[model samples]
Target: MIFQNRSRCRENKSIFRAGNQVLQHTHEYTYLGLKLSSTGNFNLAVNELKAKAMRVFYMIKNTIRHEIPIQTWLKILQAIIEPIALYGSEIWGPLKTQDFSKWKKEAIETLHTQICKSILKVNRATPNNSCRAELGQHPLLINIQKRAVKFYQHLKRSDPSSYQAEALRCQEQNRPRSTLSQLMLKLQPDQHSTIWPNQIIQLQKLNDITYWKDATKSQKKMELYLNLKRDYKPAEYLSCVKEHKVRKTLTRYRLSAHCLAVERGRHRQRWQPRERDCVCVCVCVCVCVCVCVCVCVCVCERERERVSECPLSGCRERTAPAEVAAERERLCVCVCVCVCVCVCVCVCVCVCV
Candidate 1:
């Protein structure tokens, strides 16, 4: 593949000969699963990664029940989806956060938030910040940054005479925006380091690279989780959930794969109204009819008492007719009241069941 501007690339006739055969020109190609584009950017690779991750995510989503614990879902995402999305990020991940690169970061963040919202069974309208806050998940860009750094560290620790180490040296000297240089600039040998955007953590001992990496990551995760809790308002669904129970469940699951998925499922179902109009209508109608019958009986007994206490001798003879008229009037009122009550109950159940 040729790396050039559109006009120049179109003008140039690119060909290659291997053995006795000639190779055709191509604008882009995939090497070791990374797509190299003539456009001189990893945009295509990032997009493909995002697409692949989403495809895997959908397959998981369809195959597994949403009733899975939040922690399990998170593990699935980190183990499966994130690996796909962050594949080869070591090469392209550390580009200075610019237009397309920044957008790619946001895109990955969006995917992470989407998965979080799904796991929590929250609405699509839930704010992304709140979603991340609720789940205690750091922005995915941070992971990409870490991957890039670890790869840089691996190269530095590798054989100096090796091709990869030599390339790293060349990039460090020539390319300021290269992954190695970027990691050097961000993670200087200091008391602390800034791994990604807005994240700062102490790195008192860089000699022990593995230990330092793990310590910094844990500290950053805790700090971010706390900051989010203190700053952002919880999602509507989250706010309605029992705070203590949620925290306990999340903590338990994070510590170990606990079988407390049903707790969250219960909370979600509580907030989610199931609108079965036929069932609600039947229930409300039965209730209203029973209530109205009780009221009608009371009214009819009162009418009978009034008729029996009549001062006229003909009142006794007229009791049957009077009772019939009163019964008719009361039945009309009872039916009207029952209908009104049933309609109101039905609407309430439909909206807030």
Candidate 2:
């Protein structure tokens, strides 16, 4: 018995109906066989069962479905199905007993080998080609390379435990090597610092040597502070040198020392006061004072002139000069004559009485 293909049968209703009828008949016959098996029709029952099994097989064949790909399925199925196929007979037998420990050990070993091989393959396949041809040709690369060599030598001398023997061996073998500067140029900015600190130091040293020649006095001082700060943490180094009690004193000393140096440098250099500025301030003050003095003098002169021009006697009308003089003399003489008359009257009265 064969099941009809869905695609081929879809276009023909008669074919689809015929396939459905066949499936129904197979189910009915299989059910009838189960019902009749208790009766004496054992041969007929066996034939019906075979027919139903054939129908199920045909259905599966025509399905063409997959959960896993064929290759993966074969590999996985070999592990699962092989054991079961080999042990199926023993598994059902009353005398046979299962041993899971042996099977588990075999499976673990197989998985471990597979995992290790996969990791090694992945590691081997990673590309290590560099894109630093231009960097290799740089002029500074040689100097940086020398410095890196020296730094590595220092590291080896200072602490052999910290330096990897393999890396040091590689450096010794590869002489006339390109400096880390070239390598750093190929790396990201953040990666450069972590990858090549010694190279960075050499580059900075080169810059400083050049800067010392051309930098101004103030710039040199600033560079000194920057270098110190870069090499040592300000708070930690200061704390180490001076205890808490003397921290402020140390800080003041440092600040005063720097300030004095700056002041001394300024003193050594020629610095003239701005003449225009000084003259402007002096002229402004002089103009203000002169204006105030002129105003005061004018006020005093005006008051003096007003007082000198004021008439003294309010009763005097317009009078001739000679008449004024004669009146003045007559008034004086009359005052004298009255005083004598009073005196004589008093004497005569006294004598006659």
Candidate 3:
């Protein structure tokens, strides 16, 4: 038989009996300085964070009376306000927005926009997206996704059977429709083809903040260096990597002249008795090496003369002043080497024979 209304066993009014006292359930409670709702929503906590961020922003504005560099503000945001406002956000954000209630959804969106505006010093007239671009900051939504991705990368390499891993596995399998689940499913395949490695972002542990910051700075510097090198003219690169063209030509010419002299002496002694001939295995090797070097000298010198006007050799990119200087230097070297090699060879041949 069903219980009557008079039974006073209503779900809302239900009480539990302890050994000597009664315990009651409530809709809200405070845990670890954050409000916890019975329905497990964090709207109140987000609101509190937003208010605190506003207060901190004002405090920073008042503390600095002079025209301080943006770097100082950046350090404060990074060191204090950001951490305080985003303390527990990593737990809930970067997931599907559909899973959150309307209040939380609105609160998160507003929180990100307001925080961005405050930090970037942009008035309401300027577009938030443009402000983010100007400051080289990611959108609020993407920031959350970044954190989630960083955490996901860490958990992926952990022991599969451990508590955190098991929980994540379960969540992944059950929450396929979540924003993070769908995002990874869509992007994981593309990650293999990307230059960035999957494990590079696993710097999400508590103690890795300093390491991560330093690593980011280094990566940016490396990227800048690579870009500079890539766009630099081939002429500059040649100078950096190879010996001076004049020096190379001079060395080759000297060796070639010595070889020519030895060959010519052997030729002149050909009419004499075979026993008197100075030609030997060493002479033959020297002649061959001289011939090969002479041929190379001619070829390289001719190519440089032919392409003297083209600093890039074949490309159409405009040459820089440094590249022009480098080209002129190489040209001078090639001319000197070619002239030395040719004159020495002919003179040695005439003199020795």
Say which candidate scores most in lDDT. 1
TM-score of 3: 0.44
**Candidate 1 residue-wise lDDT, 217-314, digit = tens:** 45422443344344323333343445646754553343222444432343364443345656676787788678877877777786666666665535
Considering TM-score, which of the candidate structures 2 and 3 is the better prediction for this target?
A: 3
- Give the best candidate by TM-score: 1
Model 1 RMSD vs true structure: 11.4
| lDDT per residue (tens digit) for residues 1-353 in model 2 | 22243243333233325654633212123342242322223334433433443344336435646332223433432454323322211111111111222321333223322222221122221111100110111122223333444454454566455556555556546633522222333322464234455566556445433443343234433433333332211234332543433543443333223234443455466653677555655565555556556655655565445444446334344343564456545644654565455456545543432
Candidate 3 deviant stretches above 4 angstroms: 1-14, 96-109, 115-122, 177-180, 189-353
Measured with C-alpha atoms, the lDDT of residue 310 in candidate 2 is: 44
Q: Higher TM-score: candidate 1 or 3? A: 1
Report, for all candidates in order, the number of backbone clashes.
0, 0, 0
Model 1, position 51, has a per-residue lDDT of 85
lDDT of 1 at 175: 59
